[model samples]
Target chain A: MASARSDRRISADHIPVKLVIAGPFGVGKTTIVGALSEIEPLNTEEVLTQAGTLVDDLTGVNEKTTTTTAIDFGRLTLPGVVLYLFGAPGQTRFQVLWDELVRGALGVLVLADTRRIDDSFAVLDLVENAGIRYAVAVNHFPDSPQYPPEALRQALDLDPRTPLLVCDARDPASARASLIALVEHIRELVLS
Target chain B: MTSGRQRRRVVPDYMAAARLSVPEHISVERTTLVSIAADADAGGLDPPASHLLALLRDEPLSVYECAAHLGLPYCVVRLLVAGLVGNGTLLTRDPPPSDLPDIEILELVLSGLRAL
Candidate 1:
């Protein structure tokens, strides 16, 4: 029985899937991950130093200087598989890290805030350019203006094939719905 | 907003060289759980690399976790991990997402989320 159980146990090679929650600053990306993750989210942070300034491209974030950005992570373990949910660090300068971050990831979940929809464009572009399959979920804020799905689709220039979902990062059910939608989309992609 | 002034870009070549100085074989992948090899006395490791091996003597930890615990930059930790992997002083496994989780496990995971 012990040997049989070992055959079915989860290991490094058995099933390792990473799903990235990506968006611009203040889009509740970490909140969503916290809602779904089994334990308290762990964060990886690096101080912004003088040398780091050279490598980081601070386009929209010109006003900020002294800040530490963190990559938040949560895990889900199954019998023979484990899923990791990572909140991508929000900073254009961290672009170099994205390649390493997305390595071995199954797909991406792009979260957008209606208040500032344009912030998501960069995240979408990066994920698309990386050739990773992704789904977009709009994190609805109470103060943000609401638009129809088609209107958002036009603004974001989303291909019809991509899935757009509505989510409330604070709510467990809402966040789970968004993840389930993305998972279905991933399944569809695999089938096709 | 340049105000018609041609400002010089401060190029920190030393910093670049230092951070990007990973050995040729060290690829940038999210590191796996790493432990010190039995041959801890292997020579030629830099101070930081040797220190990293010493820290790992207790238990294996992921590169990111180690960086957080040590308060070091991710790039530096990555370089050390790569160097150790190259010299066989550290052992690592491939990252996750290769296996299938049965529906029961998925449900349990979902339940965990629901509890939160």
Candidate 2:
């Protein structure tokens, strides 16, 4: 079976592919990771150095030199590769963390909440400025209002090339489709 | 009624405990994959390095996962991993290329996701 082969491949050598699932707080980033991760999602605390402050300070005194944040991640083993999905905090204050998280990542999926659509702008800007390919997945909550695809695209101010879709983070199939959309978007960019 | 509040301990200086300096290229990202070296000799390794080796011996894990399992901060784990890597006791693989991956890899991932 593919699972047996994948297990053996992982023990041996296989490519490690990383993708970021980033959005504002309470945007279901962790939920999507939990739904798609083969094993339970794990959270780890990361320390972000205040490099900007450290560099800008002429005096030796530099308070608040570091900030720690907990990031959740999940792993999925493909045939000969292990795909790691990192659920990252999308607030402006966590921009330093975003710089580190997106390093060497294949792409990013920005999860958005329709009710709080404005919260996703910072993440979208971060990814765009980083010059990395990304797709936006609007995680539909039971109580949130729904909008047409075109309206969401305009509201989010997504580029024409960017892929936008709605997903239910609780359902595996739905979550998987969101990921597939992101990958397909990446493929398009690579082929273009 | 007894006070339910407990005092918080001061954060430890992880940098002070670091014995080896990490390389410029080695990142502390949670997704960076790490594995044990094929010819790793377990003897005489420090507790933290030995523990990291044992964890990887079972199976390769990301630096973040190592921290989670060992109850250490990500910065401390990166230093420990760097120590192991410096001594050729462990191997590290950075996450996929910074730019878009090759078309073939993207295809493989898409197919895999589709199958799921």
Clashing pairs in 2: none
lDDT of 2 by residue, A1-192 (tens): 995655544554667888999987667777788899886777765644354334332222123243224577788888767898898877666777888888878899999888778777888888888888899998887777989999999998989889898899999999999899999988988889
Q: Of the candidates shown, which would achieve the greatest TM-score relative to the real structure?
A: 2
Pairs in clash, predicted candidate 1: A14-B99, A15-B97, A15-B98, A15-B99, A16-B96, A16-B97, A16-B98, A17-B97, A56-A93
Which runs of model 1 end up more than 4 angstroms from their true locations?
Answer: A1-14, A47-68, A90-93, B1-24, B35-61, B83-90, B96-116
Which 10-residue window in model 1 chain A sums to the lowest lDDT?
A: A7-16
lDDT for each candidate structure: 0.66, 0.76
Per-residue CA lDDT of model 1 for B1-116, tens digit only, reads 11111122122223323633457866535546566666656577555665566667655555665555545556667776877687677776555442332344344444433433
TM-score of each: 0.66, 0.83
Question: Each prediction's Cα RMSD?
Answer: 9.3, 7.8
For candidate 1, write residues A94-134 as lDDT tens digits: 77777667776767889998877887888987887778878
Clashes of each: 9, 0
